[model samples]
Target: MPLDEDLLPEARKSYRYQWYVVAICMLAYVFSFVDRQILSLMIEPIKRDLHLSDTQFSLLNGLAFSLLYSVMGLPIAILADKRSRPLIISIGVAFWSLATAASGLAKNFVHLFLARIGVGVGEAALSPAAYSMFSDMFPKSKLGRAYGIYSLGSFIGGAAAFIIGGYVINLLKSVDAVTLPLLGEVRAWQLTFLIVGLPGIVLALLVFFTVRDPRRRGLRRDADGGVQKVALRHVIGFLWRHRRTFAAHYLGFSLYALVLLGMMAWTPAFYIRAFSLTSSEAGYLLGVVVLVANGSGVLFGGWLVDRLARRGHTDAAMRAGVIGALGMTVPVVAFTQVGQLWLSLALLAVAMFFASFPMPASTAAMQVLSPNQMRAQVSAIFLLISNLIGLALGTTLVALVTDRVFGDPKMVGSSLSIVYGLASVLTVLLLWRGCRHFRRSVAAERAVGEPAAQPEGVS
Candidate 1:
């Protein structure tokens, strides 16, 4: 699936534009994370204000967001493939930004939960369109690198959310003595949500003005001014025929999500209880680890995968996922077992490094393996399963098991760690299985004379 040598010069030039796309997408992703996860840092204040429990916090973070987000992903992704992606992304950003701002007005769990759903609905447009755009922009040979850069946004954004969330909360707490006019003596949590949510508005405007819509090259407009060839049923049927491949990748990613989302959702609390770090300190340190370690892992993994693909190893990406899954388990174990804060932080960085490597590879593999038209829907389907199962159930189940079964704060983090370890093991197993079938399927696909899916919009 490598590009021809004659096209290499153009591909190199095209890669520059792909980096631009990455930069913009990364900014959008950062705002998304800031809005979504800033709530976690304020969990203590929110919980105390609302008289909620650990399980309720889990629902706020996981289910309320995932429920609508997961369900709406497919239809939105379908719209992205057929309509203007830049427009879709712009509208999504605006909607989510507004929702994040609205969260500041929430008076209770139900109001906040509804706002979270809005955030989820808005953010779901990003991955499908961004991934599709990457496929179109870059040549096939350069997609791994392009995707790697795009994937870095996730870590950078997530890390920023942690750091910024903590800082905003602490600042609000300190400034309680300085009362304001309309919103007098705002709690740390309320101010934290308000401050973090505001930046997304500017980001939404930037996306609207800067990104140009890429036209679908081969499509013909019907009398109604719609592209004639994109059929929803056809995409579903293609996935149905490739069930095993899809299932393997789905399970692999879901297991990865289960552990990853669970750990991230609880890690701040864990640091509070286990390491005695203030929320701000934990957030700052976590941000550094994510920005450096996880970000490098993403870029490196993409570079490695692209290099391997050039050498005629098509399964290199999946193999990277397998190796990353295995390596991640080590740090997961070390972080849970070790008591020292420095050691645990170091291991957490290592864990994030390995954990991030598979993201671009896995996402690229899914897109490459799918037919061009089905990319968004397939991505949506995977997101649906991964979010509903992993995000919704993963953290909630762990919290219930720890608080209800174990009956102690100290035991909660350790108990969740055990769940993470088991999930990591399962991720490796499923990815290994997927790797076995990937080469055969890819070869068969190429032999049948279907055009290899190219990197979209690299130029």
Candidate 2:
């Protein structure tokens, strides 16, 4: 997957625009998470206003969003493979941004739930297109770094949701409520959603204008050297032919995501309940950790893997993922078990750091293993599986354990421990298996041919 081999003439000559594309895509990813994750910080107010239990709120946060996000990603991704990826991304960004604003206007649980669904559908269009574009823009060697940089949006957006949301909520708490001209009085939570959602419209326009779709790489061409349209069945057949590699990849990452998303959805509540911190306090503290620790982890992991790959380690990305999974387990378990706030936060920070590693690696693997024509579809399938398992179950499982098993809402920390600890163990096992299959897959591809062509002066 080295860039020298896969990059087109235009891309090989102009490296600056590639970085610009990554930056813009990263911003789109940032806005996606900001709109999606702001809900976690607003949990208390939302629960109170809607008269919801932990289980009910979990449904709104997890299932309502994940269902549409997972189901719709495939078709949208297919469109991305065939059409203008930037344009598709622009439409998605605008749709999700509007949906996020609409969330502020919801008077009831159902309305808010529907808005979240829209947000899910919109956000689904992003990563597949982004991943495909990155594959075409960068050489295989830099895929890890490119994806890692793009993935920073998750932490940045999550942090912004909390830090910004926390400050806004704190500022507005003293006042009863703010009255909008036509909207009448609005709660602090509603205003928080509105403030975060509107700016993304401008971001969408920026994406439309700024990001260019690169020529597709690593595609199967006809006798005339024209790229063929990859059929859906062809994509399915490719996956089936390499089922073990994909199975391990998908299952392993889904397990990792189960732990990651579970922590994200409930850590604020865990902080509130365990340390008696206010929502804003919890948001700000965790926000800082996510921005710093997760951001650092992603960059470090991507750089490490790229360096390893350059040194002739074809399985470097999978190795990094395995190490990350193992490293994350102890800190996450300890974070849940610890009673001291400082100790717990420290543990949580370490856990987030390691948790960030596997994602860029996973993304790199997807690009390396698939043809360019099939890359978007493969990515969509990955997201669909990961989100369905991770987003759909991550929060709900913790809530179920708290409400049903512990029979107490305050035992959320224990529930997180139970869920994440088990998931981490499973993740380690699956990733190890995946590493073996991934290496074999890489060898198989290399044996078939040297990459399309190694461009001079690209690296």
Winning model by TM-score: 2
lDDT of 2 at 252: 93
Cα lDDT tens digits for candidate 2, 169-213: 888888657899999988889888899999999999999897778
| Candidate 1: regions farther than 4 A off | 1-16, 176-185, 217-228, 455-459
By TM-score, how accurate is candidate 1? Answer: 0.91
State every prediction's TM-score relative to the real structure. Answer: 0.91, 0.95
Cα lDDT tens digits, model 1, 25-66, are 878887887787777766677888878888898899999989
Off by over 4 Å in 2: 1-13, 450-459
